[model samples]
Target: MQVASNFKVLFIAGFGPIVREPSESRELYCEVLGIPFKEESGGYLHTEALQGAKTFALWPLSQAAHSCFDSDSWPEDIPVPQAWLEFDGDSVEKATANLESRGYRILVRNKQEPWGQTVTRFLSPEGILVGVTFTPSMRKEK
Candidate 1:
């Protein structure tokens, strides 16, 4: 008999809808970001596009932690996560410049990662951490 194996983690999901200094308004995910997310009848967003194998959703951080019980909870005083998105691109520098010009704050400049790939980071208006990277040299090895 063959047993089925569970799908391993494919991506990271950062829950949102948080109550913070600058609330991540629903429009950012629904319209501005153009994520095309699904929502419930009550108008709660179901999920956002991580654009990968891992599924990311939006929920109150406290409530989300409770749903995923048996783990350490988020500290009430600590800053909640800023969402992250990593991408494989041809020119990270160019992308970074374009994004920066568009008003996205550069969290980190385009630098070569220890893994030997070019990467850059930026923050969304809501303080979400987003990134873009390319591993062309590494991909060639494969």
Candidate 2:
């Protein structure tokens, strides 16, 4: 059976683990792995220095919950995600529609973040929080 996709994925915008223990995660990525990450407000740590992914970060669980549900606590009804993966797509709306048509429950649809990325989020079968997004900053010519 062939499944149709309405949107094209341009690239992997970002990938990261959803960190429950910020100190442990920070020590691993920053101290042990030696990945240089800049800490932002609310304990968000990110870097564009990694070669494979456009953006890699230690996304705190609180932030992830806030992004998806506008709250600091993860909803008990949904499984807690272990990691996050974002694919930059040609059209977020088209991808969102395609996902819905295929029976995937979308957590958030085409929500524009404060950082200007337009994203649609859903949980994958493996419990990874996946996002189809259009990120202007990542698309810029380097």
Q: Give the best candidate by TM-score.
A: 2
> Pick by lDDT: which candidate is best?
2
The lDDT of each candidate is 0.55, 0.81
Error of 1 at 89 (Å): 1.0
- In candidate 1, which residue ranges exceed 4 Å CA deviation? 1-80, 137-142
What TM-score does candidate 2 get on C-alpha atoms?
0.63
Q: Which 10 consecutive residues of model 2 have the lowest summed lDDT? A: 25-34
Q: How would you encode candidate 2's per-residue C-alpha lDDT over 1-142 as one tens digit per residue?
A: 3546867666777667766678756764565335689889999999987656676678999999999999999999999988887878678998888778767789999999989999999886557888888999888687
Give all TM-scores, in the order shown.
0.45, 0.63
Q: Candidate 2's C-alpha lDDT?
A: 0.81
